[model samples]
Target: MAPRTPLFRPNAYFATRSDVLFLGLTVFALYVVETLVLFYALMYLLLDQIRDAPPALESAMNEVFSTVAVFTVFIAVVALLVVAAIVHYGSGGTDTDGTFADAVSVAGWAYAPELVTMPLSYLAARREIATLTFDGSDPATLQRQFEAVQQSVGPASFVILLATVVWSVYILAAGTAGTHDVDVRKTILPALLVGFGSFLLGVT
Candidate 1:
């Protein structure tokens, strides 16, 4: 039988704190841009609906706001998972690997985080737009805005979730296979699930 490897072996050349932080910040910046684009597209769609005239701008805006709110909730939930991942890896994992680089590589598991969080940011922007449309002083406005943000964030979040599942498997397979000098095809699924689940649970 093949010798068993350590559970947490880290690569010597893996990322440092500087690298992880830099990469994280860079990722966040890109996420913000993606959200901005999605918001812009949503606004354009809403505008078209208004132009069509059967559904007044007011109604279209309301529906859009509501949708955005749901999306925000979805994003918040996913964000919790991501935060957990950061905390686990950042604090030094219990895994056999002592290097931060090993934990950092777990970032390959963060595909869902990226997919979900970007859209959440867009929904947040949409909520801001909704506020401008709605009465500022209305006692109910706060609640309405919150709801709209949640709805807007949810749908896109689902896509992110799905993508993460697929990508996580790929990263795990590739990373582990490379580490052990094994045929990658044999390890793909295990690697992917491990990578994906670890990130989601913040145990990388």
Candidate 2:
């Protein structure tokens, strides 16, 4: 049997049974954290809109919603992995000794890049939001504030977003190839498709 790969090494992270389990858990944990960060930021953004609500009540609601969002993200991740595994098998890509579990494990670990990207993206967003001055009385002022926030975030955030997408695709391809015992060339297309789909899901 091959030795386990280090968690930080995307190409070999899912190479062994223990490594697969570890990476899957790590990715899930990171997803939960990311979801929490996103929800917390969202709650801050919406706080002024819900200013009439009690502070404690609003905080509790945000916490509950964040928890639910984390579970939703977990389910989505699992569903995506299952669907990808089925498609790979149906396409006769399972000619190697790898099983459905192996494919799912690799797919889960492929999300590891988000561990870094999500936090950085959130920080960038927070910084952008801080620069905006909201005016509830004037619709035009509010629109300008929104545009200012976008302009502030556009250049740097776009570069970060592009880098994250490319890094994720590369890692997914490597993980798919390593875990499924398929040639890297054969995995690239599926990896790219799935990576883009995941990116859209995350952003939306």
Candidate 3:
């Protein structure tokens, strides 16, 4: 039997079945927190653009609830995909030395990279939003201000976004490879496809 590894080290950890439930719960919680923080930051940006914005406490609360529902659905879909991938590849003569539970656990931990990047991205956006001067009464002025805000944060935000995505893809690839006993190269395409699919799902 292979030795067990710490859950924090997903590449090695997914190979073992120890603490799968705990790790999945932890990842789920982290993902929720990350998503909430991201949406809050976005709300701050949007609210900042309104010159005479109405009291938004209620609206913000509504948005939070809606976002939670969306993220819950998104995670569920991703979990199903992970299970399908494991089953399909396992039947293809590949030595996917792990089970459905292991794939789901790994998929959960695969989100760890975002724990770092999401908060940083939110901070960057928050900072840029703070610096913007708003004139929401005039649509053209508001658009220009929004554009300026984007330009101010665009480069750094893009870099962080890109790096986090690549980091996530790398983590997912490693988790898939280790859990499935497949070549790292074999996992790359699947990881890219999954990542892209998830992004599309999130946006829509």
Candidate 4:
């Protein structure tokens, strides 16, 4: 709960228009960078397949990339809106009154901590992938390398990863509570689902 991070008191801090705009734009920029990296990696993998492709086929491939890029950007915003709507309507029954705005801001701002967590998650994945690469397809050596990597996560990194996840989840839960004006007890399901979704997205 860093003071400047804004998750500590999401309800109070998000009241201003400027805060909402800033957080939204910052997260959006991060999302753009994330998508670019993913698509670039994808393109690298597909480059050889297209090297001898016909001119018409190359043009079609370009169009496909454009379509997918646009679709991903649309999903970037739509995902948050969907989460907001879900939490707003999904909260425990009637007396839970909160604005759609509150839910949207909370959903977007809650992902701020992913700036720290996703890279760590990505690196760990790459290491595991590296360990599994086959030089001779020997089962025993591959198993040993996999086990070594499974145990190789540094203690400090693990603690940091766990802390960020908890911090992010706490922010999500607190925001959900604020959104519903309900007790933490009522927000558990939404909190856990959102938190798990975030983790799954990052590691993927």
Q: Give lDDT per model, in order.
A: 0.44, 0.62, 0.63, 0.60
**Root-mean-square deviation of Cα positions for candidate 2 versus the true structure, in angstroms:** 4.8
lDDT of 1 by residue, 1-204 (tens): 221221122222222222443443344445544544675566654343222233354566578766876685567446534533443333333542333343334343333255455565456445444444433344365347535644553444455555555554454444333333345554454445454554454321
lDDT of 3 by residue, 35-133 (tens): 776775676666655785446544755776687768766875566556446433643324556555656666666566667778788877777677656
Superposition error at 164 for model 2 (Å):
1.7
**Residue ranges of candidate 3 with Cα displaced over 4 Å:** 1-9, 55-95, 134-153, 198-204
Ranking according to lDDT, highest score first: 3, 2, 4, 1
User: What's the true lDDT of residue 162 in model 2?
Assistant: 71
The numbered model that scores best in TM-score is 2
Better of 3 and 4 by lDDT: 3
Error of 4 at 31 (Å): 2.5
Query: What TM-score does candidate 3 reach?
Result: 0.69
Q: How well is each residue in 129-182 modelled by candidate 2, as lDDT tens digits?
A: 555446645556655654555444445566677777777677667666666767
- Model 2, residue 60: displacement in angstroms? 9.9
